[model samples]
Structure formats: C-alpha cells, structure tokens
Target: MCLISFYLIFVFSMTLFIFGIYFILYDYSLFIEWEVVSMNSLSIVMTLLFDWMSFIFMSFVLMISSLVIYYSKEYMFHDYKINRFIMLVLMFVGSMMLLIISPNLISILLGWDGLGLISYCLVIYFQNVKSYNAGMLTVLSNRIGDVALLLSIAWMLNYGSWNYIFYLEFMKNYSEMMIVGVLILMASLTKSAQIPFSSWLPAAMAAPTPVSALVHSSTLVTAGVYLMIRFNLLLYNSWLSSLLLILSSLTMFMSGLGANYEFDLKKIIALSTLSQLGLMMSILSIGYSKLAFFHLLTHALFKALLFMCAGAIIHNMNNNQDIRLMGSLSLLMPLTSTCFNVANLALCGMPFLAGFYSKDLILESVLFSYVNFFTFLLFFLSTGLTVCYSFRLVFYSMTGEFNFSPLNLLNNESWIMLSSMLSLLYLSIIFGSILNWLIFSSPILILLPIYLKLFTLFVCFLGGLMGYMISNVSIYFYNKSLHYYNLSSFFGLMWFMPYISTYGVINNYLMMGQLSFKLFDQGWSEYFGGQNLYFLMKYNSQLNQVLQNNNLKIYLLSFVFIVVILFMFL
Candidate 1:
C-alpha cells in the first residue's frame, strides 16, 4: 500500500512538472522584458526583467523536480516513514516551482525563503546528531547571505522600484544601487556555497543522497546561478564583472581542491556541484546569457543523474558510501555500472557528453569576454582543473576494482528511477546539439568565429584527458602521493580556518587553553601581580581605621555643611 501511494504521488507530480515546464519552454519567446511603469511612482523608467532568461530558469526548476521524484520513488519505497519523506519532497519541489515562476521581488523572496525552510527540514530529516548539525550549519551559514539579499532588495525598492525588471534597468543609471546587486550576489554565494561562504555544503552531505543531489543540481546551488542569470543585464562594467569572474574562479579552484581531498563519495559530488556552479557563474560573468542558460539546463541533467546513482550506490550497499570501499563491479552491477558510466562521462565532460557542451560554452564565454589574455588564461587553467576533478570523481568512485563482495541488492530500479536516468541521459546528449544548431544559425545571431569555438573545444578536451590519465593510477597510491604532497594546502594558502570558525577550527583542549588566555587578558594584572598588590595595600592601620571610622559621619556632616554654605552664597 505504501509503495502504491508513493508511485501514485510521483507519477502525478512529475506529470504536472513536465507539462508545466515544457509549455513554458515552448513559448519562451513570448516572455518579454516586462515593466511596471509610472502607475507605481517608483517605476519611472523601463525595466528589463521577466524575460526569456527568467523563463529558462523556471524550466530548470521543473526538470530538477521531476527528476528528483523519480529518484525518490526507488529510494523511498519500503520504509514505514516513506509517506512523510514523500510529503517533504513534494512540498520541497512545489516551493522550487513557485521560486522560478515568481514574477516580482516579493515572489522571488517567497521562493528564496522557501528554499531555506524546506532545506532546513530536509537536512535534519534523519534526526541524528550529524543530520541535526548539518541542518543547523546550513542555517547559520545561510543567515549572512540572507541578510545581504534582504538589504539589497530593500535598497532597490526604496530607490529604484519594487519591480525586479526596474531594479536591473535602473541600476545602471544609479551606480549606488550596484551595492544592492553586490549584496544580492552575496546571498547567491551563500546559497550556492561559493568560497568564503562555502563551509556549509560539505556538512549538508549528511542529508539523504536524493536530497543532496536535488540540492546540488536544482534548487540550492542554482539560486546563485539563477541570481547571476537574472542579473545578466545589470552585471555590466569590467570592474564589477571582473570581481565576479575572480570570485567564481576562486570557488571553482578551491571547491575542486576540496573534492580532491574528500574520500567520501557524496562530498566529492557536493564539491563538484560547487565547482560546476562556479563555472556557471563565471560564464554568466562574461555575458553569454544564452550559453550560460544552456549549460545550466544540461548541468541539471548530468549532475542530478550522478547524484541519483550515488544514492542508489549507497542504498544497494547497505548505506556504505566510502568510495575507497567500492571497487571494480563492472560485472556484478552491470546495470549500475552502465548507467553510472554514462553519467560519469557526462560529469567529466568527455566529448559528446552533456558536461562537454556546457563546459565548452564557459570556455567560449571567457574567450569572448572583455578581459584580456590573462583572464582568459586564468579561466582556461581553472577549466582544466575542473576537468581534472570531474574525471577524478568518476574514475575514483565508479571505475575501480571491487572491494566488498556484491550483495543481493535490487540491481534494477523501479520505473521512476529508470525513467528519470534514461530521460536525463537522452536530454544531456540531445539538448546541446539542438541548441548549438538552432541558436547559432538563428537569423539574429552574429555567430562566433569558428576558430574561437574550436580553440575552446580543444582546451576542454585536453583538460579532460589530463584528469582522466591522473585518475588511472591506483586510487590508494594516488591518495597517498597527494596526501604526502598536501595538494589541498596550496589552495588554502590565503585562508586560515581559525579566523572564520574560531571555535570550530580549534581542538577542544586548545580551545580551553585559548579561552583561559582570553580571560587572563581581560583581567588586568592577573600575571602582573595586581591581585597581590591590592591585598597588600591595607587602607587602615589601628589608629587610621579608628580615625577614619569616626570621621565618616563627620565627613558626611561636613559635606552637608559645605552644601549649605554654597546654597547660602547662591
């Protein structure tokens, strides 16, 4: 009965998402840069909001929700609490749906706030110590981001207008409003877990794999990309855009490094999610709206598919997810292997894969951007690094020798899981090619020089190759070599964990010692013998004590007398 209800809800919900999302997609051109003009005194000028770009984001929201339901069906089947899980997932999906379609600042805030609310519950779903910590961490980390966004919104409404369209168009004339844009970008950084705001994501891996996958691909991380995508117009000027490029590149590098450091499979995926979002943002920084949105959709397909497989891998293995424990199961889990391999290649951006399309687009975006050769070079190096990590993830997690013997896990997924993976695989491949052909050839497009596109492709392919080669070395040995070298330390050169998470970074014993030192500093003369001096200084000897004691009343009487004297003079 539980199984039947789960299936029913999934089928019905997904049907709605598919129809709703695609209908919006089919009529994307119909969406205009809407403006709420003069009637609302703040809307003095034309605004560029609620366009095809926003519509594209809505489509992604739909795709992720539909795919997640499919993943949850197989994942949630037999548990007695399955009903509750399904309910949360449904509500979560609905919130995201509302988030993307939201028309105004209030609507966007509703969606943005909904992300936190549902995500908080979802993270703590297990009610374990670790899960609770993750949920709390998620909230604490996001608060800073939330503040920045709220302030940004307030500034815009007070100055420009309440309308999102107006905010974008008006920001150019009113340069001060860019502060608001920056604040909103900060919120995006927190939501997407970009660097300096990036600590909560690895902790968030404590959620169920499906939740992690959904968070990474669709709702959580995409908020940043969605913000950047939404403000593609406002993110003008080399200086502001360059700052974004640097931040995005920083996140891309550091997150990939973190992915490399983690042995836990889920962390690898989580960090990869961060890295991919960085690339997406970087692409947006370069003003390739069409390419950015295109990659965003393809990224949703493959990243979610990979996460679904990770969830499946854990489920089938009695929840053991240490990739080091997994080995070559090419034969034992043929179905898992086949589906996972395709997803893995897509993740690594092997040619013709979904990732390949988007990754190449990012390179193109950088190449075509206003930044000179150094920015281009810096972005290229980062792309290569991304390819390295993406492939390393695939090679380390999926393509190794079998460590534990295979259990009699259900090798075949239920209809939901199979359908989602299959559909994603289909979309990941076809989506880019169709876009490549149609968009480039559009009568409107002054297409990019062929040489530039070819160069970007070459760079992407070379990076993929380098990463793949490195991963082929034995996993244990590879880890040992990297550990001895301390590769991650390079990225952390400028970052000190103690400064950001003072209590969190220190060991308990060290923390106690630090606390003692702080207390001592506040207590002046603790070590300087001030306490001993205070005790040594006696205020009264026998004669002096008696004199002072007798004089106390006299002193009060004298003071009163002096007051009377002064008053008489007045």
Candidate 2:
C-alpha cells in the first residue's frame, strides 16, 4: 500500500514540476474563483491560485511526502498502527496542499488550521507522555499564528473580500492595512518557529522521523514563508519589513547557535531547519521573496534528505538518537553516511551543492542591501554557525570509534529506505542549479569587492575549524559546561526559549489559575455559591422545622411578631 501511494504521488509530483516549469517559462498564472455565498453585496468565495511558485512548492511537498511514506514503510514496518500513521501523514500532506494553493484568507485559514491540527496528531502519534507534551507545545504555539490569521481574516472583511491577494497592492497606501500586515508577520513568525516560537520545533522531534522529514522540511514550517511570499507586496516600504528583518536575523543567529550546543541527532537537524527558516524569512523580509522561496525549495530538498538519513541511522541503532553514542557509521553504512554527509554539506552551503546557489545569492543580496551593521554581522555569523554545527554533527556521528553495543549489527540493508533516500540524494545535488536557471530570467548580477565576496568562504572555513576543535575535545578534558553550568544551560537550552515560551509565559498565568482554582472553584465561589446556598437552605429548613414542630408557644410567638411588625409599619 505504501509503495503504491509513493508511486502515484511521485508521478503527480513530476507532472506538477513539469507544469510549474512550463508556467514559469511563459510567466503564466491561473486563478479560479467560485462564489460560495453572497449576502447583500458581500460575496464569500473560494479561490485556487495556480502559478509557478505554488506548482513548484506543491511538487516539492508532494515529492518529499511520498518519499517519506515509502521510507516509513520500512522504518515503521514493525509498528502495530502503521496504517493509522499513513493516514495521518496523508492528512498532513492534504492540509499542506490546501495551504499551497489557497489565496483567500478563509481558505488559507482552513488549510492553516488543518496543518496545525494534523501536526499535533502526528507529533503525538507515539502515544507517550513526551510526545503528548511536545504535541501540546507544537499546537499551542501554532494556535497563536492561527489567531493572527483569523484576526487578519476578520480585518480583511473591511475590504469586502477575504481574497487577500487582491489587496496587496492597496495595502501600502492604507494605514489600517498595516495592522493586517503586522498580524500576518506575527502569524508567519510563529508558524516558522522564529524566536519565541522556536522551542516547539525541537520539542516536536518527539514525533517519528518520517513526520520530521516531511513536516520540518517542506510542509508545516514553510507554510509561513509561503504565505509571506504570497503577500510580499504588503511588506514593501512598510516598517513591518524592518521588524521582520531584525527578528528573523536574530532567529537565524539564535537557532544556529543553539544547533551547535545541541547533542540530540534529530534536534541538531531540527535546529538547522529553524535556522534555515530564519534565513528564508530574513530574505523575504528584505523584499526578496523570490530569493526566500528559492531557498525554501532548495532547503526542502536537502533538509528532507538529511532527516531521512538520520532516521535510517536511528532505525538501525535501536532508536538511540544521542550523537555521543554513535560513531564510525561511515564504515558500517557507507551509503547512508555518504548521503548524510552530502545533506549536511548542502546544509552548510558547501560550494555548488543545492544550498550554495540559494544561500550564496541570499548572502550576497544581504551584503548589497543597505542594512545596519547588526543585521550584517548576524547574517554572516549565522552562516558560520551553520557550518559549525554541521561539522560537529559529522565528527560525532561519522568519524569517531563505534560507541554503541559492539554486538549490535548496523547496516544499510533496507532497500526500501535506501531507495527513497537515493531519489532525494540526486535532487539535493542538482536541484539548486535547475531551480536557479528556471526561476530567474536573467542572471542576478552581484557586484562586490573581492574581500567582501570571499568573506563568506572565510567565515565558513573558520566555523568548520571551530566545529572540529569543539568536537575533538577529549571527554577527559575539563568540561567548561560543567564549570559554567548556567551559561551552557542557557545556550544549550536555546537561550531558555522553551522555558520562556512555555513556563515563562504561562508560569504566572498558571499560578493565577491555581489561585483562581483555590479562590473561586475551591474557595470563595464554593463557599458563596454552592456552600452558601446549601447553608442558607439548611438554616431555613431548620427554622421551618422548629416552627412546625407542633409547639404552640413557637407558633404563637411567630404570629405575634409578624402582627406587631405589620402594626408598626402601618
């Protein structure tokens, strides 16, 4: 069943890729609109936008998802609930597709909400406490973005249509539309796991590897980037763009730094995804949505492959995800190791690989753009940190002595998994060049001084060296992290972002909730509401019982008191 699904989706992906190229060649777009309901000059419409970007992005998404499904057939073969897993994955893909094609805010919301809900389901698929907590974090973080989208949708009602694509041009002139733009930026930031929302991306790794390959790579996280790309016009000449620039640059730097300190194999990759997302968002914020989209596609190709390789390794190693316990995998699983290294190098933007074309262009563009020194430093430093983490991961996992149980046999014997990875491996090597040629009509001319041009290479080399040095440190050596526990914890813990987003934001509220529970549910409300009513009813019944005890004295006294009160009032 999985193989058949893979083949069907693979063919569809190729078809869409061809159509996307043809559309790009002709600069063609197709917009289909259907009115769902009309109420007194206000019409609700469902719209589908078919353009080169959508076609190509959808193609990548479907392609990666299909490969992941095929790979999961082997990875999850022993699982009792593989069928349910497949269905959830399919639902996830469907939601992402809906998001890719929708231009209307309402339809986008449908797809957006679907992605969040389906992702939560996928994240908790393991049925464990950790998965459940991760799922809650993932869903709650995304819900903030959902609220932003809903509010933006509501704001769009002023223009009498939910098709926000139409309003992009006019948004720059109207001050009110700036609110919508800011709201959209907020939505995208949360969706893309920028800054405060970043903790969930790594936490979400409690999910199965296949879900990570699909969700973290092409579909769920990129939804925000795609949305911002679609609404690029709203960002032009807007202060929101600068805000996006600063925030995204910081996100890029932070995630890259976090990746360096991380030891979890999947989490290292997850943080890399977060860093790349920040890169895409930063480029998009600088008014080069095309560059951002370009990076998005290229990133999807390599990042998905990287996760698949990690999954293959994990599946072979009894599901141990600690890099410290993995070593010399290249000797046992050469093909998987080769693929893993390729993906890692591609992630580092090693020259001429898939990432280089897009990443290089983005860096050059940033250098060319008139931005403050801080943005400039963050961009280059983040690029370097990316290389650092990639090298560190390789050193720990592929170069050292075998650290696992010696009796365990690890090999790339699963043809099913290897075949799917090989497909992406080829794409990761060549897709960037193909995309570069097809997406741009004329070559982008980047004129910079020789020193400036070579600066990126220098940073990458320095980062690689630093990564090697850090990873090469003997375990017997003085542990800096142990000595400076708080500092290391802060960096290793993503600058305490998880705590800030989860505990920091909610700690006070939770305390308030506890207080409310005590004061209201268990205290004042309990006493004044149910308890007070119960006591009043009890006292009244007791008084009535006493009055009706058949005591002539009590009855006579009550009647005389009532008669005297009436006489006094009269």
Candidate 3:
C-alpha cells in the first residue's frame, strides 16, 4: 500500500512538473488572487503569483522531490516508519511550493514557517541522539530567519499592507525602508546557512540521505536565495548587498577549504552544498539575480544527483560514510561511479555540463563587475578550491586502492535507486542549456584578456593537478608529513566553526546567564524582593500582632500623650 501511494505521488508530481515546464516555455505569467478579508480600510488577500521564474523553480522542485521519493522506496525499505517519511517529504514539497508561488509577505510566512517546522520534523525523524541534536540545531538556526521574517512583516505594517510587492517601488523613494532589506538579508543568511549559522548545515547530515538530497540540495537551502531573487529589485546599489557579497565570498572560500579536510562522504557533499550556496548568494549580492536563479536551478539538478550518488555509495558500503574506506569503486560499480563522476565534474563547472553554463557566466559577471581585489581574489580562489575538492573526492573514491575488503558490488546496485539517479543525471547534463535558451535571448558578452578569459579553465586544471597529487600522496603518510599541524587542523575543523558556534557561543551566553542568575534571581531579587520582603513583612506582622493584643491600653496612652503634647505646645 505504501509503495503504491509513493508511486502515485511521484506520477502526479511528474505530471505537474511537465505541465509547469510547458507553461514556463509559453511565457505564461499569472496573477491569481482571492480576497480573504475586507476590513474598514484594508483588505487581506491570498495570492499566488506564478511567472516564468516560479514555474521553473517549482517544476524543478517537484521533479527532484519525485525522484527522491522514488529513491527512498529501496533506501528506506527496512524502516517501519517509511510512510511517515514519505508524508514528511510531501509536506516539505508542499511548503516549498507555497513559498515558490507566494508574492505577499503574510502568505510567504505560511510557507516560510512551514519549511522551518517541517524540516525540524524531518531532521529528527530518526529519533536518535545525533538526529535529535542536529534537529535542535537546525531548528534553532532557522528560528532566527523566522523571527526576522516576522519582524519584517511587522515593519511593513507602516504601509498598511502586507503585500511586499507593492512596496518595492515605494521603498525606492523612502530610504528609511532599508531596514526591511537589512532584516530580509538577515533572514536570508540564516536560511542559507551563511557564516555563523553554517554549523547546522553539515550537522544536518545526521538526517537520512534522502532528506539531505532534497533539503540541502534543491529546496530548503535555496529558499533564502529564492527569497533574495524575489527581492533583488529592492537591493540595487544597497550597502546590504555589498555586505552580502563580502560575507558570501568568505563563506564560499571557507566551505571549499573545509571540504578539502573532510573525509565523511556525506559531510563533504554537505560542505560543497554550502560552497555552492555561497556562490549563489555572492552572485545575487552583485545584482545579477537572474544569473543567481540560473545557477540555483542548474545547481539543484547536479547537487541532488550528487547526494543521490553519495547515498547509494553509503548504502552499498555497509553505511560507511568515511571516504578513506572507499576507493576504486569505478571498476566495481560502473554505473554509480559514472554518475558520481559526472555530478562532481558538473559541480566543478566542467565545460558543456549543467554547472558550467551558470558558473562560467557567474565568474564572467564577477569579472565584469567593479569589485575590489579582495572580493575578486576570494571568488577566483574559491573557484579553484571547488575544483580542488571535487578532484580530491573523485581520487579518494574512484582512483586509489580499494581500502575496504571485497563485497558483492553487484548485489548493491538497486534498480530503483539507479532509475532515480539516472533521471536526474539526464537533467544535470542538459538542463542548463535548456534554461539558457529559454531565458536569455543571446549569450552575455564580455571582453577580457586571454589569461582572464581562460581563468576558470586554468583554475580548473591547476586545482585538478593539486587535488590528484595531494590526495595520492597524503593518504599514505598524512600524519607523518604534517609539519604545520595547527594550520592543517584549523582548515580541517572548518576554522573551528562547529566548536565556535556550539561551545564558543554557548559558553559566553551560559556564563552571562549564570551571572544574571546570581545577581538577579538569587542575589538582588531574592534578597530584596523575596527574602528581605518576607522578613520585613514578618516583622510588620509581629508588630501589628503586639499592637492588636494591647490595642485598648496603647490607644488610651497614645491619646493622653498627644493631649499632653498639645498642652505643652500651647
């Protein structure tokens, strides 16, 4: 029964995906709305604004969700809670669809909040300690974005409407409304796991692989980028945009560096996801929103495929996530190896692949923009780092000696998983060209020197060389040759991001909390408001009791004393 339902959903989603693609190709833009409330001067509305952008994104989301669902049938066959898993994924898909179509802030909240809550549910679906911890971190990190959205909505009340679309033009004239952009930027950062909020993204690997494929790759993480894309018109020449450019470039460089030191297969992919997200954000920050959206879609195709391949590898290798234990699988599992290599190559922006179209455009756009040396250096270096880690992944998993003992690789090749992977592989190869044709009338033109024109190619070659050489040599004597142990450790541990985000942030707040408790809860408030007040009340009550017991005589004596005092004054 569950299997039947899963297939039904997949079929239904696929149908919608095809229809959406057709609609987008026809250049059909729609504004569908219904009035929910008509107040004295304000009308609450429920609206779905569907255009080419939404259609493209929604179609991709549905398609990826369908494939991920199909893949889950075999990957999660043993689990008793498979039905619950499917339902959560469907809910996630629904929430993302809502977000994709929404044009109003109030309506977007319904989807934005839904994503945060549903992702928390999905993350802890395993109910293990790791899942629970990761879920908590993921939820808490997203809560910041949630709060920022709510605050932005509240601030938008100044316009007497929650329809942010109406305010974009108004915002241009009123510079004071830049606060909304800043808040929205904050929200986007948390959702996309930029910088300080980045720990949860890799930690979120504790979730099932299918969840990672969807949430990290196509849907949840991109929500921020999608939001920024929607709001890009408002951010023209804004300082917040410049800040995002700097921060996102740093994020890109940081994640690339982290992926080099990472051995866990899934976490390496997750960090790569982070790095790509940084690319999307940095490009969006520079005001090339269309380019960002293009990359987002192409990235969705390949990254999801990458995660699926990684999941298959993990499942076949007795759930071992360490790449150190994997090697020479190309000979053993040709299909999976081929798919993995293709996805990795695409992610590295190999020419003619899905990623190259958007990634190359992005780098060229960066070159064309008026950016400083720091930003330009980070962008190019991060580009090289991307290829570097990708090659390292390929070498570690596909080229080196078989580190693990022999297993029946033939038995591990599940038809269901392969079908799902191949479906996406098909898209990963051709989706970018399709999008380029549909969206751009002609290719963007840029003129640069020969070296600059071939910058990405040069970087790719240099990175591949470094990756192949380092991965081969480091595997045998990594520990023996580590002279700069501290420097190596810093990059390995993601610049201590996990430690800093967890213990570093927690310790400071916890110490402050303890001090606050001692000073206010225990010391000042307890002494003055609780204990001191209680003692003072007790003394007053005792005095009152004494006065009441001797009230008659004491009243008479007091009256006589007053009369005598009055006589003496007179």
All models, RMSD in angstroms: 8.4, 4.0, 4.3
Indicate the worst ten consecutive residues by lDDT in candidate 2: 473-482
Evaluate model 3: give its lDDT.
0.87
**Model 2 regions more than 4 Å off:** 37-43, 474-476, 526-570
Whose lDDT is greatest here?
A: 2
- For model 2, residues 180-288, the per-residue Cα lDDT tens digits are 9989988999999998789899999999999999998899999999999998888888888898888889888998988888889999999999999999998898989
Angstrom error at residue 263, model 3: 0.6
Ranking of all candidate structures by their TM-score, best first: 2, 3, 1
lDDT of 3 by residue, 250-336 (tens): 999999998988899999999999999999999898889989999999999999999999999998888888998888889878899
lDDT of each: 0.68, 0.91, 0.87
The residue ranges of model 3 lying beyond 4 angstroms of the native Cα positions read 1-28, 38-42, 406-410, 477-481, 511-570
TM-score of 1: 0.76
lDDT of 1 by residue, 1-570 (tens): 334544564566456445545545564433334455757455433222334444445555556665666667677776578668767776776677666655456656767877887888989987899898778778877777777867876776575355665457777657766776778778887888776777788788888877887888877778767777767777876366778878877777777665655668787778778778877877777777667777777787787877887777777667887876776555556666667778766766677877776666566556655777766766776666666766666666557666765554536556677777777777767766655544443533334888876776576678778766766664544544556454455453324332354246434647788887777754665745666565556543544666567567878887999999999999
lDDT for model 1, please: 0.68
The C-alpha TM-scores of every prediction are 0.76, 0.92, 0.89
Residue 243 of candidate 3: its Cα lDDT?
Answer: 90
Residue 555 in model 1: lDDT: 80
